[model samples]
Target: MSVSQTSGTDAVDLAIIRELSRNARISLAELGRRVSLSRPAVAERVRRLEDSGVIKGYGVHLDLDRLGLGLRAHVSLRPRLRSARKPQVLRDRLLAMGHVLSCVHVTGENCYELTIAVRDAQHLEQVIEQLSEMGDTTTGVVLSEPVHPRDVDIAAWLLCED
Candidate 1:
């Protein structure tokens, strides 16, 4: 399964992306073996993928409980009527704050959705306190994650036109 990063990406490039998405730490030799290419060939494709920005950076997903970040919450921010804060300004402020795992600009009544990981209720409250200053926030603590984020679908990607 190859997920091309760009329009002109070929099968080998997509295959390389797919394998790496499954296991980023997989050895070049192992990846080559799986994709039926030599180590050097696989390495070249990986390098090309990186250069084209298909693969951004390799990362490890940590267990929040183990990391002492046991509390998880989504804070939805709705723009207030007389507030002069622009979205970019709010974004910059959000970026500066700690405990914000992911922040995305969205549509509808809410302007942004923020994923927060904190140590406990008090810590989460502190984050909410800050969020409230930015805008009116509706915070929801995550109870259980039924489905975690995963790799992209390479086959579906291949079927699409740029």
Candidate 2:
């Protein structure tokens, strides 16, 4: 169902979503307190959210730099595939690669955009070479990440509904 039509995602649920987005590691009691609900009430709401697919599985945010992957880059792929099956083949190849953090099929000149983490420039070059085999690649190394992931603006979504 569309989000606008979805039940149980009211202001309270939006508040819960906002809190969880900021920190998924928050305890149930803390989450409840933040949303001004009893722990059990909040738990039920959370369970409903999960069942409805409004809340997907939680995850960890790893520090790639701490893990020796000091370099991060965005790779834009413009496919050179002559056959229809070649795009799927490229996707499969990317899915199997450990360094590919995320790949998105996009509009415009680039068919796919990928975020990749690597140990250094050499590793980045190696990954780019692999990507080049499928299509032309334009890579931009990330100097700094001013905005991190998982910081969704749930309030803005509610505003847009009006």
Candidate 3:
């Protein structure tokens, strides 16, 4: 029932997944039409997908600029010697900060990489200052996203795996 095992799924299931990835809010009738299935059949298949853990959940994409948090930056942290042993403490602190969009633990000169959104330069400075208490921080402001975030190519990935 796992995503890589298409034995549990068929072409119709894959088609439904492709459509949902493009637009999760699409109506069931529309989804059925796109996949050549009845509405009830589509619904049942979706439920099966969910129950099998092939489809985890849906999420909303928010506009940071519209929310007045236009400044997006990436901060790389090389922990101070004292804090290097307990990375979880720093992770917990980041989880409490609303400005942190994502944090990844990495293998490199830097211990953690964080993506943060703030209101202005001052706000960005404030976030950096806070991070500095835990580690040496390097920050870079994002100019633009040329390639916007997108869904995974399910067929190319899950289907082609041997």
Separately for all candidates shown, the number of backbone clashes (residues 3 or more apart, or on different chains) is 2, 0, 0
Tens-digit lDDT track of model 3 for 1-162: 455564587777888888888889999999999999999999999999889888999988899999999999999988885755376877788877779999888998998899999999999999999888878999999999876655566745656566
Q: What is the C-alpha lDDT of each candidate?
A: 0.80, 0.85, 0.86
On residues 1-162, what C-alpha lDDT tens digit does candidate 1 reach at each position?
323444558777767777887888999999999989999988988888788777899998778799999989998988563442576676667778878888888888888888999999999888888788767999899998876765455635775645
Alpha-carbon runs more than 4 Å astray in model 2: 1-8, 82-88
Cα deviation at 105, candidate 1, in Å, is: 0.5
Per residue, candidate 2 scores C-alpha lDDT tens digits across 49-154 of 9999989889988988999999999999987876412767766888777799998888998888899999999999999998888789999999997777665586
- The reply for model 3, stretches above 4 Å from the true place, is 1-3, 6-9, 81-88, 159-162
- Candidate 3 at residue 89, lDDT? 77
**Pairs with steric clashes in candidate 2:** none
Candidate 3 lDDT score at position 149: 54
Best by lDDT: 3
lDDT of 1: 0.80
